[model samples]
Target: MEQTIPPAESSIVEFKREWTETARETFCAFLNSHGGRVYFGVSDDSSIVGIDKPDEISRTVHSIFKFAIHPSAESYVQTETLKIKDKNVVMVTVLEGSEPPYYVTIKDNNKKGRVCYIRQGSSSYEANDKEIRSLYRKGNPIPYEQRASANQNLTFLTLAEYFKKSNVQFNEGKYQTLGLKDLNGFFTNVGLWLSDQCTAETRVGFFLGNTKASESDGIFTFSGCIIEQFCKIRDLLRNRFGFKNKIEPYTLSSEGYRNEIADYPELAIREALINLFAHRDYSFENAQATVTSFSNRLEFLSFGGLPQGVTKEMMLLGISIPRNKTLADILMRLSAMERYGIGIPTIFASYENFSVKPALVCAHEYIKLDLPRLQQIPSDLTERERAIVSYLKQNGASSRKQLQDFVKVSYGTVINTLRSLEAKKIVVKQGAGRDTKYALTISLR
Candidate 1:
């Protein structure tokens, strides 16, 4: 069906006095937003002003769309040299594009960058990175995993084993069915990732302290099959971390000698790693999924933050809009992912009864989670400092008066102790003024 393009300058229409370079932005805006039309011979006031050399102007319009726009936007746009009020006007009709984030690429002045624009009333507005991501969300018909892989020759030894264990027969037919390779025999990004020939990096670093300035205890990187990488990373993390620091082990059986402990819960760590593999943006191949361990915390960072329309609070509530549904499905069947939506909740649940819960944060290019270490009481603290720590741990948040009474110290002494504890990162003061209360910090150290 043909669109009834309005002539007056508006959100979906633009008027240009000539075949000017500035029309590039308007064309880009139309491609990114809804489809719109531009009148080459029309003035900004919507008056029909005839243009000379209509044929030349049409060629120029075609040239601009072909060479000036990124991703080759010529197919989504059309031009018609028509007569309006006896004046020659070139009407360039642009259609809504399937592959969006359209932008003008200017080679002038050696400047390098894209200038994406969205349609505003009677004008075009520049779009930011977040808006560009939203455009990808709207127009991406093929998932990153389903796209054709650069490497056609690939092998999947570990992937085959996982499939065999799951009782899903592995063969060429299964490859097509699982979307590892297409009917045309081209391997997809999914096949590339699971194959032994995979080149993506997942870097893990164990640091002595909370920042990079501290000496790194150990470092390892993987660039093979995703499943094999997961196994190796799991083993390394278990060997380096999965034992109690200062906390005592819990009784595992009726026998008094049966005790077990881990500084970080296994389930939480498992879910975090799985989430990193299944949800990280594979399209952004340059960005590596990273695991950095500090003495105080464990951090997981993945490419591309929460998917479009998903909020931090929504993710916390176990709502998952997977960026790679096909990859997630394959991993889920292989038992790498227990199921959708359980990863975040299970991690939070594992931290229950602890002073600090895991921190989940979203950014434009990545999402990060900081898992604080379990609380450990230092032995060098003054009696009053230790009392405040114990009291806050037991009673949760407390006022200054409550701490003063519980510690059996002078009012001034209680204030000093609370301040000292706050400085030690053991206690966090909450609220202000008359409603002030102090509670144990989620002990990063």
Candidate 2:
């Protein structure tokens, strides 16, 4: 939906003009601040003038942003047609730039020839020297994870139950002892060590074994830098592997019949999760872990693309290099993991037991584990069986030919499937010879 603008400027910086210097200044201001949207064909007073020639207007706006603006920026423009007073209004939408400090030439000006303009509140103004310095500083802003927030309100009690479950001692005075500077510093201050505040230098956090954070945090979001890495790995796993599964429990039994594949292996799932927790370079200063479930497979992701000197060939051969010694030792003590150095091998073994091969993916920013689906019975059979059961409950009986036609399977396949049903005590035959039919013997939930 198009954002409706009033005939004039509001508190928010929105570009709403047919064509004017003010519109160019507003667009640049929004880019410099929180990226926002600009809509043309609306009066400064917020009336809908609508672009007369949307294509031409679009071309003009693109040229302006591309050629006229200094410190070139990227933006999106969409021309939408709407009905107002039984006439079409062409709406020009401009997305705010990802990078900041965008400006345009104050065309034909008497003063301030090459001055850069920025958004200060609702109005546009020439960026002062201090404002310009601030923008430059923001150009390479500090990552979210490295900076301390005075508002987190976090304490050791935030994850106290986790520590209790692990039987690890959580010294309450550790915060002040380490000179962590605050009760609610960062997970890196307690558990996983990441980069120091502002600089790229890596340092270990206070809590080593994650007595205070969940697997999700240690693997995904301990620090903002690592969290971003987790997101990258997740994307690669989704785009490349295309597997789907759930984070849950399952039991396999061989008492029924042959040829049934287990949904997943217990050992494989644990090893995958543990490998992500144990081996990832949590101090890479800009990486994380990600876990995703899909319809056919499950993905475990690690940050920092692959490791600095590791490749896909090295991974396949069960090569393991421990990244976090302190945290790893603590995990071993808590019995959450082991020192096998064969985590990958264990995961592969689990897949082989389930008659499936999991995929390993390496990208520029992440390493991914992809577990494929195991085929036991046909996927469509569940739906077909459901339809047959409902039909039998309503119609009392069904002939093999009728069932085949209804379910769209071969006659022999339907006969065999029905025979298996009888063996399961779900249905039984009635009548004799050509007059034979099938009826539900007992309802199975």
Per residue, candidate 1 scores C-alpha lDDT tens digits across 47-154 of: 777788888977877887888888788888788988777778888899987788887875446535678888878798788766886797688866778888999999
Give the range where candidate 1 is weakest over 10 consecutive residues by summed lDDT: 250-259
For every candidate, C-alpha RMSD to the true structure in Å: 10.9, 18.5
| Candidate 1: Cα lDDT at 2 | 32
Model 2 ranges off by over 4 Å: 1-152, 173-262, 278-296, 322-330, 352-354, 375-445
Q: Where does model 1 exceed 4 Å of error?
A: 1-17, 39-50, 62-91, 101-137, 161-169, 243-260, 308-314, 375-445
TM-score of each: 0.67, 0.37
- Cα lDDT tens digits, model 2, 199-275, are 22221111111122311111222332222222233333322221232211111122211122233564566677667
Please give the distance, in angstroms, between residue 234's alpha carbon in candidate 1 and its true position after superposition. Answer: 1.2
